[model samples]
Target: MQSIQIETEYVTLGQFLKMIDVIGSGGLAKWYLEEYQVYVNGEIEQRRGRKLKPGDQIEIPDVGKFEIIE
Candidate 1:
């Protein structure tokens, strides 16, 4: 897996959506979440505010893996 650095100490699921430009805007994160297309460590993650710590792995079907790093 590859790693992506976060400028902050930690981040949330919504922050990730914004970070990667996964959606056109922040509001799109909510809409995408409703589609249930986001995953963490291979399992579907439904919480928008789920705390993402260093070493966490997030998987988006078309986007591949995004492993968190300092």
Candidate 2:
């Protein structure tokens, strides 16, 4: 797993995806979220606006895992 640092108190799923270079834009992130599988701390997640804060973990199949830090 890798770690990503965020400056805000929280980051939305779509924003995080783009920040990590997983997707080019929020639109692509939305489309990717709908077309692919994503998980938050081990549970399936589909919401683009899902709040991700420090200590949160996001996993994208075939891509990798990311741990959030502030």
How high is each candidate's TM-score? 0.86, 0.94
For model 2, how does the per-residue alpha-carbon lDDT over 11-59 read when each residue is reduced to its tens digit? 9999999998889989897788889999999998999999999999999
Off by over 4 Å in 1: none
On lDDT, the leading prediction is: 2
Q: After best superposition, candidate 2 residue 30: deviation in angstroms?
A: 2.0
Per-residue alpha-carbon lDDT of candidate 1 for residues 17-38, written as tens digits (9 for 90 to 100): 8888887776677788888588
Steric overlap count per candidate: 0, 0
Positional deviation of 24 in candidate 1, in angstroms? 2.4
RMSD of each: 1.3, 0.8
Clashing pairs in 2: none
Query: For each candidate, what is the lDDT?
Result: 0.85, 0.93
